[model samples]
Target: MPTPDFIRDLRRHVGTAELWIPAVRAVVVRRRADGRVLPSPEVLLVRRSDDGAWTVTAGILEPGEDPADGAIREVQEETALTACPVRVAGVFAHGPVEYTNGDRCRYLDTVFEMETLDGEPRVNDDESIDVGWFPVTALPESLAEDQRMVIGWALDAGAPAQFTEPGTSHTEAAGEPAAQHD
Candidate 1:
């Protein structure tokens, strides 16, 4: 995944205090022909060029861009995978990721469950050092902690759309009953 020039310039000047930004991530999964999701289905993940930690296809939404469209575009831009979001899987306020230069930023992100329409993943841009599909149970050891929970839930066919409240333990919010997706 290539880092846009504007982002590179912004990073150079960003300082220690946390900056909040809206972002989106695509949890793209494969399904069996019968429409049942595969157990331990493969998911698309990308290794960050700077940190090497794996994260799902994601990016900051361009000014006023819709989150679903951003999710689709980011998946394509980052992984060479074309996808369409099925539904909202979850939403979160994550980070305070402190860069080496001490600049920190937090993401208010929406995670969407998407179905791949075409294309195999390859590193499509420089922002990512590598890209591949991995079974949910065998994800890369360097997977980003912020993304792991949602990835797990999305892979589990029985899991429902999760709604998390910021600043609380994820466990405390894990299993409230809710409407199911089709």
Candidate 2:
């Protein structure tokens, strides 16, 4: 049997056909400075040059890239921040998404909480022309509904009401959930 088109695109980076899944990743960026969390937590976002819409720093993982490592790398590449993805914030299933370039695919987005180390980011790739930090309170009006939702959750990652799966215990301060967005 031949692989389906959706599956083929999903596995194009893979060396061989095996059990497979299509995935997306984003770095939920946060600043390390004090007094940063308040009425709104500013997060790094990029406006795609292709469609003129804003989105979290993200990308499809390469066949061999560790999912978590790819999240870190994508964020760095998009935001130009020296940061670390400290923990997985949550997973979201964004059913088929259609890109402006004619790529249609479903993605299971793995959101990661990232801590930044230095300087603000400049636009780093053709996917985007502008990148900057914005408050969780007033995210860009153009963000994709799904991207807005995940960024909203990531901002409240320091709160203490949301559920964190047991294995996500590597994070010491992982209980608080932020209010829903989008």
Please tell me which predicted candidate would have the highest TM-score against the true structure.
1
Which 10-residue window in model 1 sums to the lowest lDDT? 173-182
Q: What lDDT does candidate 2 reach at residue 66?
A: 81
Give model 2's clash tally: 2
Residue-level lDDT tens digits of model 2 in 1-182: 12335556655665343322444446456544465544556788877775677777777666667877887777777777776776677775443333333434445466777777666689866667888877777787756555665665666666432333444431223332211111
Task: Show where candidate 2 strays beyond 4 Å.
Answer: 1-21, 31-39, 98-103, 158-182
TM values, all candidates: 0.77, 0.68
The candidate maximizing lDDT is 1
lDDT of all predictions, in order shown? 0.71, 0.59
What is the alpha-carbon lDDT of model 1 when measured against the actual structure? 0.71
For every model shown, the clashing-pair count is 7, 2
Q: For model 2, what is the C-alpha lDDT against the true structure?
A: 0.59
TM-score of 2: 0.68
